[model samples]
Target: MLPKSYFDIFLVILLVPILNLFVYLHNSFSTSLSYLGLPYFIEPDITVDADHVSSSSSPATRRCNIPLSALLLRELLPVVKFSNLVDPPNSCSVCFKDFETEDEIWRLTNCRHIFHRSCLNCWMGYDQKTCPLCRLSLVPHDKEEMYNERLWRLCNNCQL
Candidate 1:
């Protein structure tokens, strides 16, 4: 019969590598699962009808001019600043007038979105709430109404 001490040594030697292998596999599986769990936004290879395109496509593809309320919100959010606005050689979205150094403008903090101050002001005339590019909603001082407004905008934008 094998001595008890020899049996114990053999068991330890055999189990140690197996335990290490199990631990290694567990760590590898956890890393792979984490990667798999991440949200991956990928554009589908198939094309859809033009009508659906506006609703389904990303904000970068949206045809409707940026809303005004979104532009005005810049004054309130620390994310946006007045100095961030720049003079552009491009055309003004509101007047369809070309940009001149004299013309006022603002850039979106998240995406560096540039727009003529007038264009954004005209948009604000209606609602005046979020950033046009990133679409980050601003908190309105009047609680209930602003919250509802923010929720609606988020739903609409997120669906697209």
Candidate 2:
């Protein structure tokens, strides 16, 4: 039988290449994802718990420039069911998804650019105030102040 020292050396020799391959592949994958503007290490999905008042404050949905999403979409540019005539032509600018019949659609008033309802929600969740395609103000001129105020209040969590 081989000595204990020989067995340990053999084991280390076998493991060294495996560990090297792991590190090399990890770095290669991270490099490829970086080119696509994706994070090398992705955070696990975070779900809101009972402790949090809303999902907006949750880490998963936390955005640097948090806007009043509900107010903007629900009260300002309301979602409407997509129909051939009523909806705009072409795919959703935000998510690049095709608009289908019965899909909920949100159309910006100023530029009339259309997007999927959920796509718009996701965009607004990032606190983007302009159209994703044309970079036009999403809110109407008369409601700009009110939208900003709501955004500030919700982001700060204080009445203004």
Candidate 3:
């Protein structure tokens, strides 16, 4: 049988290439991994708790009523007069319309202002509650229609 010293040397020899290969692979992978935007060496799937129900997952029957209050000032009042001349016929402020087409008439929600839905959605996503044009306050005061008029008053105050 081989001596203990020989076995020790044999083990060291066997491990050296494996250890070197591991170091090389680690270095190679680490450099590539840095290019990807990640905080750590590993990431796990995000999980939500059972107590929290997703808004999208909420059952239609369980929620019987619409959040009427969530409607913006524009939806609350349809009779209010709005001006398309503030920006331009095709030039919408929401998307910064370049007046490209006649069909591109921007609809101002009941808020007496105008914007492309794309731009407005982007703006609203940031939680702005006023019309971009008339500056009407869009928050719901109650279930009544006064919310639109109240917003208009707020807009008037803002203009002054």
Model 2: worst 10 consecutive residues (lDDT sum): 43-52
> Whole-model lDDT, candidate 1?
0.51
Residue pairs in collision within model 3:
74-109, 74-110, 74-111
Q: How close is candidate 1 to the true structure, as a TM-score?
A: 0.31
Q: Pick the candidate with the highest TM-score.
A: 2
Question: All candidates' TM-scores?
Answer: 0.31, 0.50, 0.32
lDDT of each: 0.51, 0.66, 0.47
TM-score, structure 3 vs. true: 0.32
User: In model 2, which runs have C-alpha deviations exceeding 4 angstroms?
Assistant: 1-66, 69-74, 152-160
Candidate 1, residue 98: Cα displacement in angstroms equals 1.1
Per-residue lDDT for 74-100 in model 2, tens only?
467856777844537878776777888
Query: What overall lDDT, based on C-alpha atoms, would model 2 receive against the true structure?
Result: 0.66
Order of candidates by TM-score, top first? 2, 3, 1
* Residue-level error in angstroms, candidate 1, position 73: 2.1
Best by lDDT: 2
